[model samples]
Target: MRYSTYFLGCRVNQAEIEFFEDKLLKLGFEPSKDGKADIIIFNTCAVTNKAEKESYRLIRKIFATNPSSKIFITGCIVPLNKSFINQVKERIVQDNEVLKKNVDNIYIIPSTQKEKVIEIIEKEIIDKPHFDSLEISPKFIQRSKYYIKVQDGCNHFCTFCIIPYTRGRSRSKPVEQVVNEIKDICKNIGNNSDFGAEITLTGICLGEYGLDINTSLAKLLKAIIPYIPENARVRLSSMDLITLDEELIEVMASSPKICKFLHLSLQSGSNRILKLMKRNYTIEQYLDIIDKLYKTIPDLGISTDIIVGFPTETEEDFNLTLEAAKKAKFHRIHIFPFSFRPYTFAYQKMRHIKIDHEKVKEFEKKLMILSLEQSKNFITERQGKEYDILVEEGGYGYTHNFIRIKTNVDKVNCFVKVKIDGIEEEKGNFAVAKGLVTLPV
Candidate 1:
């Protein structure tokens, strides 16, 4: 049997697809380089209403293209909403009413058990030629760096978010497993003839890496760091403010192999909004964690997530968010207007302030402008500065601190020295730097 898979949204989805690939190979299924396969798996995301809709659209398109192929739908989409699956069924029926009668082999991959997920992949490959068991890994074909989902799911149920219901609770891979996986990946990369790359550790909540078993994220890092090859880099996905401790900061600051970029998910700035969201940190505590990291990590790049237009977000609350963004001067701000997902606590409440569509757009626009201004200041500070850039393109890459740079030479995935040029008046600061910078001996 031949199989191919499509993953949508988040690193964890990608990681799961990689595992499916391993299972398929072990069961004797050949990987379809193109979409021509006996089975096509759509690993979907349902983080938001838009995501759910998009998942359905993708599934329909895949089935239309390969009408004879067996289709499997999985990921956060199936478990979160029964109505959604019904809607998907209707959409397919309306499009191809006659075909629906013959398409009776549809399967919804179970999410509650990892064993079930594996079983589906294995069954899809049943009766195929047996091959050696392949290690669960991603192909470094594009090698523009990688994301290793070191953990899965989240325990925090922020009022506006749907991830908790979709992904279940937080679970951490054992320290030994994580280390071994990374080491094997590094070894595989060394043997590959095509490209050299590094892996970034990602999770639903990275700082909670070892929380399930009382092992600290710092301890997990201590285990994985030594295993990554010196030539390859390791980056963090997102850590919470409450999880920032001296040990973790020290490891990040001192490790040359770790990228200086940190994404701390600060959903909102107002204490009231924070409380409503059930976030564990106060604004002051979050600020303190950022301060500690900035003082220790030279030229660190801090980015954050901001959710504006929450259920009860006031004009004052939005201003507080602006104030914190200015103070933090984050290099990146992924500002999103809150979208209500069904089944969350905030969904049933009617007394909260409603965000008119026009007003929500205005707020998000303002947020983007504020984020750009902070980025401008960061680029100004680094003007005429040099950095060790991990080259990911022929002549383009990002600095250790996560500032993007472009050039016209063969510089992909190789560390090179470059001088920071002033931010271009257009395209924001993502296009600065004259070229690679040499490190001082």
Candidate 2:
């Protein structure tokens, strides 16, 4: 049977869906070139109100387009949307008696048991599967580089977040297991294509990687350094500022194999709002970490996540956030309007409070302007400097500090030294600088 999958979320969700794809491929199932397929897996995200609506809309579209196909819905939406889960079952199956008898075309898998989806397919869709004699690669097939999930779940119960409830407490894969996976992927290293070549270790909460395993991200990094391909580098998914420490900083600073970029989270800058949101850090603390990181790791590109127009966030609170962000000089800011999830602490305690939609838009625009300014400033400073960048498709690549550069280099999937020639004059969300490839590294 042919299969197709859809995922709408973060790098962790992408990695999970890729894992499912690899398994299906190994089982001799072909990918559907068209939308229609015998089996379709759709991974849902409930991180925001908009995302939740989009998930449902896509599910409806998929169902309508593929009337005869068996559909599987999984991810945060499946487990949390109790009424909607039943609504979908009733809407799809239409027979209460049939649902009670455990017969349905639509299957809803919980996020916790999402990895066991293949087992479900084996039992329900396929039996006595023929194994491929050729070895199936253990790395992610969707991209040129390896994307591994070293950890799952979040321990921090931040007020605005529903992840801790849906994903559960932090747990980590063993260091040895992670190292072996890295080694396995590097054994057959391929050229960089689109998305470039790099091993990005992703997780629900990246900095919480090693707390459960009595190890640390630093230790894990050291263990895998010898295994990473010499030409490729590694990048961490978003990290919590509170969890970053001197050890990890040292590991990052001392290694050329690690990307000189860190994506830290600073949800709110107001001290009071931060406490209310349970972010566990003040603006001062956040800046101090930034200062230390910049001083330690030269030319480090620091990006962050900021939620705007949160309920109870006064105009002064919003100003404070803007001020703090300006002071930090972020490489990029992911601006998100506050999304209220029903199971979160903020939803329960601050549901009555309302934020003006216009205010959210105003705040988001302000940050976008700041983001553009920062990108320009960052590129201007590195105007003539040469840096080694991993070249992918379309003659585009990103610097170690995460600046996208367009060049004339044709080599893909390898590192090349390039000098910044000029910046893209056109207006956009962020600036993409122009560079001249000196030589392939």
Candidate 3:
């Protein structure tokens, strides 16, 4: 049988979809790239109202375009919170509930029961390999970077986030299992230099990895580093400030394989807002960590996430955020207007101190503009510097420090030394660098 898989939300979702795709391919299922397939799997997202709306709209569009194809909806959107699902279902019931009429062809699996996807497929579509007979392999499609999910779920339920509820408690992959996965990908791809050189370790809460198993992310990275090939690099996904310890920073500092970039989720810079959001760290502590990271890692690319216009956020609080952003000197800032999610703490609290819609919009616009300015300044600072970049499709790639650059080099999935000359015109975010020459792996 032929199948197609799609996902929305963070890199963890991307990794999950990739895992499903790899497993299906191994189970003798062909991929349907272009039109209708025997099965279409949608790994959905419901992080925000916008995300939920997009998921429903996509589901309807897929059905409208391919009426006969069976649909499987999973991920954070389904079965996480029954009330949330019911609310979405109510909307579907009001309009065209496509799945209601064709119940046999549509399946809604919860995020917790994602492993059952293959089993459902076998029962509903076709039976091929026994569960025990499947041998997994890596098929890293986006450039030569392989994303390995080292952990699942989140224990920390920040008030504004619905992720912990959707994903459940945090659990980690065994260190040996993670090491073997990376080694297996390297071995399968061979020493061709065209693949298996960059591995991004992702999870819902990456720093919380190994806590349940009596180990830490530092220990896991230390164990895995030796197993990776000389040319291969490992990148950690986002982490909370509280979980980032001295040991982890030291490991990253000493290891050349670890990328010199860190993304921390600083939801709000105002300490009062942060406390209300239930974020554990203070602005002082966050800035201290940033200072420590800079001192430890030279030319570090520090990126962050900022939430604007939260409930009870006053102009003074916003000014504090703006000042904090300037003080942090973030390499990149992701500005998100506070999204009121149903069943979240922030949603309920919003009723008491909701900011005006126009003011919120103004805050969003201001933060976004500041983010762009910060990004441009960061890229400008890197001008005339030589760095190694893994060339990707369309001659675009990113440096080890996470600076996006476009080069004239025609090759894909190869390392090249680039000298940043200036920022790319019209393409405001990244730099326009001159390709010096191809670098040996």
Candidate 4:
């Protein structure tokens, strides 16, 4: 059987889809590359209205192209939108009873029950399990780079978010399982003999990992360090300010394998807006952490997520955010416009705080421009410096400090020291550099 999997939303979704692919491959399914497949699985997202729209759009496009293929739609979107799920179920029942056709071809599994996807496929398509349960090693799709999901779900219910509703309460993979997974990945890399692999610990809320258990992320990192290969590197995905502490910073700073990059979601810099959004930390606390991180780790790349045009954001509030952005000088800023998601507190409470749509759009434009400028300045600061880049396909790679560098080096999935010569283009978001030398593992 040939199958294709598509995912939308965060890195966690990406990790899940890859896992699905791995399981399907183990079940004797070949991955279809030319958009023609016997099975099409869509792991959808519902982070925002736009995301939901895009998910539906992609589903329509896929169905049009592959009309004969069995379609499986699952992920965060399915569980959150109960009406949509019921609609899909009703349609399937109608097709089965009224048309006397097998409705098993189309399956809808919620994100919570994603583990049963393979089982569903087996019963619905194959009529039985094709293979016995076998231990499968983690696969690194991104040439020598792997994402390990150490945690899943989120606990915090920020006013402007619906992730908590979609993902439910915070939960974590056991510490032993996480460490063993990394070890297994390292073993696989070692056996491949192509190159070393870097593992990125990803989750919906990474810092919230191990909160349910007795251990913490700091403790988990300490435990995994000894088991990891000497050449392998580890990276933390986006984290919240509340979960970050001096101990985790110290652990990262002391470890050579940990990437010197941190991404924190600073939705709004204005204390008033932050409070309205139900964020625990203030601007001062966030800046203090940033200062500490920069002092502790040399050449550290600090990136952040900023939300513009939040509810009750006045001109003064926007100014405060602007000032904070200027002060923080984030290497990369992911700017998002305030999207009103249903069932979120922001959606209910923010109706009275009306800001013009045009005004919100303007603020978004300004913030994006500022972010680009900041990125350009960041690249400019490293113009003459040399850094080791994990050369990927397409002559592109990123340094330990998370600077995207484009080079002419043909080597892929290997390390190379690149001396930054100049900015790549007028925007200056990426640097054009020349490879100085290939670095050994």
Candidate 5:
């Protein structure tokens, strides 16, 4: 069987698809580069209205591209928005009875039982590893340098997020399993080429990695760091500020392999809004942690997520968010407008507060501009300073603590040395490099 798989939404979805890919290959299935395939699987996202609509469109496109292909839809979207799945299934599968029978193979699995999910993936989707062994995909794989999913699901049920409902309770892969995956990845990279890149361990909430078992993230890091290649950089994906303990910070600070970048979620800067959102941490506590991280790691790439307008959010509350953002001077800021998802606590308990759509857009624009400005500050201050840059395809890439640089180069994923020429801080995006970090070919 030849199949082309499309994954939508977060990194976790991508990881799951890779696992399925490995299974499919073990089953003697080949991956399809183009749309021509015997089967097509879409790991969808319902994070936003746009995402859901786009996911539907992509499914339709997949069906159109290969009418004979058996189309399967899975992931966050299917469990939450069954109507969307039904619509797609009806379009593709047609007969109701056959569709029901076929769709059973694509239902979203619970995160609790890894062995069961693994069995389903191996038997139904793909049974063999895509490669003889696990291999890291190309750099354009989207989010991280080397993506590793150490954790899954969300326990912190923030009023606005649908992740908990979509993904269920928080679950951590066994520490040994995670360590083994990292080791395999590092070994694969070593065999392929010299790409001394970072590995980002992602999850719905990363800080909760070892809760189910008694192991802690600090211990996990301690155990894995020794085995990880010296050249490989390690990064922790988004984490809750409330969970950042001294032990973890100490591990990060001591290890040069760990990128000084940390993405913490600060939904709102207003305590009143924070209460409404049911976020575990208050604004003050978030700030205190931010302050500590900055003081502890001077070159830290500190990024955060901020929601512009939540249910019942006032202009004053929104203003507080802006003020807090300014104070934080975050290296990168991800701003999102509130979206109401059914079955979540926020969807039912509180009356949906009407927000001026125009105002929300305006606030988003303002924040993006501020984010850019902050990024500019990092670049401006670092001008003429030499830093290690990872060469990316059609361009060169560099990371100044947390900022990324895209250079006009030939090689992809090769780290080189470059001087900071200019910065684009308004969006907190990047800085221009003066020259290539490598010598002439």
Candidate 6:
């Protein structure tokens, strides 16, 4: 069977899709060709109403376009959007012989049952029983970077988030299991120095990793540090402020294998808006951490999420967010306009109060401008400095602190030490530092 995959959410979802792709490849499946894939696995997201709608729409489009392909829909939307599931089912009920022949064509697998998807396909999908007997290995297409999902779900239940409802309670893979997985990955990839550039430990809530198994993320890092190659690096996908502690910082500080960049999700900067959102951390706490985080981790590039138009957000609230962004010196800011999502407290309590659309657009523009300005400062701070970067296929790689630098170096999947020779700022492109590789005489 041949397959195609799609996902529309965070890094956690991206990691899950990569896992599915590897699993399916091992099952004698090839990439889609001959004008139609035999299967399509779409990992959907429902973080916002727009995302949810697009997820369903994409599903419908896939079904319509790939009539012969078995469609598997999974992820956050699988549990929450039953009406859309029923809509698909209603179409399946139509009097069509082709559809009836493959009445089981569409599989709606929930997050809870994701692990069983391959098992279901193995048993149910006819004439594919010898998949396990064949000697096959997954060839990851990406030249560099591997995303390993160490944790799943979240327990925080932020008032504005539907993730808790969709992903359920926080849980983790055992420390041994994760370690073995990494070992196997390294073994398969080898120390060729031409691959294995980076591995990202991803999760819905990464900081809570290993809590159920009597360990912590900090300890997990300490354990894995010895196994990772000195050239390759490990990175956390994102972490909530509530569980982030000094221990994690200390781990990052001690290791050269761990990336210095941290993407901490700070939803809103205004104290009042934060209270309304029921976020556990306050602005004071966030700013203090920022102050300490930069002091501890040298050249650390901090990025964050900021919501622009929460219903109760005022001009003061927006201004406060701008000020906070400036103070944080965030290299990147993901500005998500407040989206109305069902089952979230914000949706239930303040649905009637709406922020002006024009204001939301204005806020987005302002934040983006500030993000670039801060990023310029970050780039300027690192200029004329030498750093090792793992060159990806595009001839560009990020430094330890996630500085994107384009270089003349074309060696893919290998680390090269380059000094930032010049900074390029163009209208459309993100500011990229020009790198010149320095070789020993």
Winning candidate number (TM-score): 3
Residue pairs in clash, model 1: 391-412, 391-413, 392-413, 394-411, 417-436, 417-437, 417-438, 418-436, 418-437
Q: What is the TM-score of each candidate against the true structure?
A: 0.88, 0.92, 0.93, 0.90, 0.86, 0.91
Better of 1 and 5 by lDDT: 1
132-202 per-residue lDDT for model 4 (tens digits): 32344455343487777778888789998878877778898888888777777777667333465678899
The local distance difference test score of model 1 is 0.72
Residue-level error in angstroms, candidate 6, position 45: 1.4
lDDT of 6 by residue, 308-421 (tens): 888878889999989888898898888888788777887888788866999898988998888877777788887799988888767788888888888887667888889987
Collision pairs in model 4: none
Candidate 6: which pairs clash?
Answer: none
Q: Each candidate's lDDT (Cα)? A: 0.72, 0.81, 0.78, 0.77, 0.69, 0.79
- The sequence of per-residue lDDT tens digits that candidate 5 reaches over residues 51-160 is 76687677666665565555666766555343554554555445545444545434343333323443554555565333332333332222226667878788878877
Clashes of each: 9, 2, 0, 0, 24, 0
Candidate 3 per-residue lDDT, tens place, 1-441, comes to: 788888888888888887888877766778887957888889889887788889888877776666677777887777576556655445543455555565456667778777778777766567654473223565634337777888888888888887877888999988888887878777754666655357899998999999999999999999988877755678888888888888899999998889999899888879999999889889999998888888989888888888887888989999898888888888677777777876678777675765687888788778777777877788787778888787888887788778788888787877777888777643432234444444534
Which runs of model 5 end up more than 4 angstroms from their true locations?
80-144, 191-193, 424-441
Stretches > 4 Å off in candidate 1:
25-34, 80-95, 110-115, 128-144, 191-195, 350-353, 424-434, 437-441
Which structure is stronger by lDDT: 2 or 5? 2
Distance (Å) between predicted and true CA of 293, model 5?
A: 0.4
Model 2 Cα displacement at 296 (Å)? 0.7
**Candidate 3 accuracy as TM-score:** 0.93
